[model samples]
Target chain A: MSSVGAAEDPHHLAHGHTAAARDEGGIAPKRIVVSYGFWLFLVSDIIMFSAFFAAYAVLVQATAGGPAGRDLFKLKMVAIETALLLASSFTCGLAVIAASARDMDWTQRALGATGLLGAAFLGLEAYEFSGLIREGAGPQRSAFLSAFFALVGCHGLHVSAGVLWCGTMMAQIWTKGFRADILRRLLCFGLFWHALDIIWIGVFTIVYLMGARS
Target chain B: MTDTPPDGKRPWQNVWRSRIRTSLSYVDGLMRSVALATRRHDGVEDDAHGRAPGPAAALDAGGANDHAPGLDPVAHRASLIGYVTGLGLAALLTAISFWVALDRETFWQPGVAVGLCVLAAAQMGIHLVFFLHLTTGPDNVNNALAVAFGVLIIVLFGAGTLWIMSNLDTMMLPPVPR
Candidate 1:
């Protein structure tokens, strides 16, 4: 049968009439539509980060006879930054759980913790960047430094955005209560925060860890 | 409109009374409409005709515990476990990644890069499943498809750049003297 005919056929509905079929057919909830759109946005963001990763990988060896990754990387500091971010992601997950359970106080507390951890992570990153620049190892020094700064700085920027978003969400929940709209926003924030952590893992491994060794 | 009063009272008095009454009714109607709109937006109405509750119904439902369809406390508890598990695994993976990178003497130095990549991919998967709630159910199939397409694009972009650049590195340079 043709695709249109199949859609019209009652048999099609009978064989595992999943939620997607019903939602797509019409009457899909606002939450589903918004989240799907948000997911698309996240995917586009991942593509952009992937491009940055590719650039970093290509120029990793192009240090222009200046300081290389091994000369500049501080594994102990990066480890602390990684820990802060990982902890923040965990707390963000807890916030989501509290939101799902409709527990207002716990949600606020978890989100507050997540925000603090995220702030600490950003602070360490800024310190690291400033230190590197002070030592004349800034992005302008070499192609390798340029790519390194671009990749890590971009991830830091995302973390900064996540911190701002977390604060906004706390205010929204305070004023609006746990309304469905607020809940949807919370869900999106959780997704965004976790995705940032994932990207950081990539950055830590490829840029910090691998670069130091190579 | 006639200026003369219908009743025996003063014309201006009659006109003022009528105008005030009309404006009062208009204000009353406006208040009622606003109240109704708020109720509808509160997200309390049931999922009629397979529809999810609207946002305003949330307030009408009276409390956060009044979850809509498909969102219950039991499921929340289960998801909590998933989140904790994801957190623990992610921490473990991060530690392992650091260890492998830092301690070059333990593992073959050449394989560390590949090992780190594998660990990073695994951590990403854990986050996607636990934190992002990405899964294979019907409701999430579209999300899965979108993510899959994204991964394909990322792989193509990354791999294609490496391939082209490495080729250029070989072909663009003049032959080195023996």
Candidate 2:
């Protein structure tokens, strides 16, 4: 399908089916192209995270006889952060749904909810990091602490970037009013947001839940 | 356009809606998506029919037959039911993991950690299927290939590193295992 006039078709608007058959010379629809591109980027991102996961696994036991994750970790705070990120992901999905339907009002509301939840998660993470620093369990103290900070901090940085992207998207939608390019951007944002939540699943499982036990 | 009235005037539907109305409307929505996802194509073009995706569904006037018959334009809506169900399952998994982790004394030692791994994997699968819409559809072949390749590399890198590092640690310590 030609990307230019695809959306202008009334049937496409009503149905939103962008299926590209194998015979279509390998060119997917614009929506699928952007979404699939983002999917590859996410896969590469996961590969990068696995390196840190390996590092953390190897170094988690090398605490240099100081405080370990069991001694310094707080499960309660980590649980809260996980919940916030999960909720934000759901809200981001809702925002995408609303954007697809061209419901400006609900899209903005859902995006706003996502941003607030994400910011709250960041606030809690910052609080946890500062508390660790104050308690003399900072990253400089041990190899384990450094690995922990690098893995979790990388995920936190992604969340920060996602929140900023979401804000900019809200503004673009408000001004451009659901243009095709804007909608593609919205799709990428939704995928990115969901990808971050998936990574957090790994972070909490490996770093917090398993780390505390091991 | 296929939305049937909630009124259970049909003799069979009377029992159905009565039993179902106690729960939120999500049950019906879930069933609908399940139906759509598993719908049979049977060599006929599925989108070749004039079925429009249900969008603005509640607010849309019942002009269901405006399109010409057999005019199938390809497009699909991301079902809201799928997202809600994904969220529900993920939340359940998270709660269970936390409960297991917090009450370590209640369960066996190493089993809890392994259980957390299973739960995390389950939750990640849920997010991929529902939120990311990963599927076996023809258009998704390339995406699936990319994911499979990435997973292969990750497994090799992570497992290989752990194996070597653990062996190195044991050799370094030469501990009381002797």
Candidate 3:
């Protein structure tokens, strides 16, 4: 079937019969293409993060005899950050369930919760970055500092984007309800949000934890 | 608009047709695997079948049944709880790692540092598998594949860059002036 035909077929939307049939029959072109497309985008995102990680690793020791991670990092603060991000991921999963069920209110609530948690995480990160800068451990102080700022800042930027995306999705749910396009967007958002959480795990491990020791 | 070629002769048509054929083959292979796995486990019957003999016989013999065709709320809730718990645990682990790194004087020993790094990587895998649900399921195998490919590229490039640059710094850079 033509891609446009597959997308527009009301049969596909009616009780999702078409989708079920395609799955059962092992012939779902649209699903495969959509899946592949999302994967391609994910791969590209990973590449972007890899570049940042590489830079950070290269500059890990540029402290100029300044205060190192051992002195600057607050385990309590990082714990809070991790909690916020992880909670946001949980809420994100709830949002996906809501979307799948076509429960607009639950979906909006979950998305809002996700956004708030994500924003809280971002706020903590910004505060951490600022605190470092205030203590004269700014990115300008060392090569290590620069890489640290860039890598963590890049992640912070993604979290910010997720917040904005959640807010927009909430608005869309309110306006358009749980339409296919919106659900697709939400699925993609879920993937993106979870991917960030996975990457943050690396950050917590490599940059903060390991750097503190080294 | 003037004159379109026949469907069989159109280049775009041929390309799409071939793509569809290839995708069908892939799906066929996946379905075969699912069938084989299911068949391999088909002989196991639980005690529920033994206790409810009549009901079980009726079910086995294909009798009337009320089927609620909709989302499974309990499964959904269970999945949500699992994800929440996983995330919470990951957060706790991250905090502990940070604490150990900051407080323990011997934590920077090369072996210890490498162990810590490996722990972090394992934490990442936990988040992916438990929280993100990136695994080999009917709905998510493609996602899992994507993640695997992406991770491969990131590891190769990130580790390679770090290794090369660290070597360069040691060999090429002049000693720091006192």
Please give the ranking of all candidate structures by lDDT, highest first, separated by commas: 1, 2, 3
lDDT of 3 by residue, A98-170 (tens): 5654557778888999999999898899899898989898988888888888899999998898889888989
Q: What TM-score, to 2 decimals, does candidate 1 have?
A: 0.76
Q: Which stretches of model 2 miss by more than 4 angstroms?
A: A1-26, B1-74, B173-178
The candidates score, on chain A by TM-score, as follows 0.89, 0.88, 0.85
Evaluate model 3 with DockQ and give the value: 0.20
Worst window of 10 by summed lDDT in candidate 2 chain A: A16-25
| B61 Cα displacement, candidate 2 (Å) | 26
For candidate 3, report its TM-score: 0.69
True contacts kept of each: 0.56, 0.44, 0.53
TM-score of each: 0.76, 0.76, 0.69
lDDT of 2 by residue, A1-214 (tens): 3342254454566343434211233334566677788889999999999999999999998899889988988888998999899899889877876665567888999999999999999999999999999999999999999999999899999989998998999899999897777877988888889989999999999899887776
Residue B95 C-alpha lDDT in model 1: 94
| TM-score result, candidate 2 | 0.76
For candidate 1 chain B, the 10 contiguous residues with the lowest summed lDDT are B69-78
Interface RMSD of 3: 12.6
Instruction: Give lDDT tens digits, candidate 1, residues A7-95.
Output: 45546655634443343356555666777888999999999999999999999999999999999999999999999988898889778
Q: List the residue pairs that clash in candidate 3.
A: none
lDDT of 2 at B175: 52
The C-alpha stretches of model 3 lying farther than 4 A from their native spots are A1-32, B1-78, B99-110, B173-178
Error of 2 at B96 (Å): 1.1
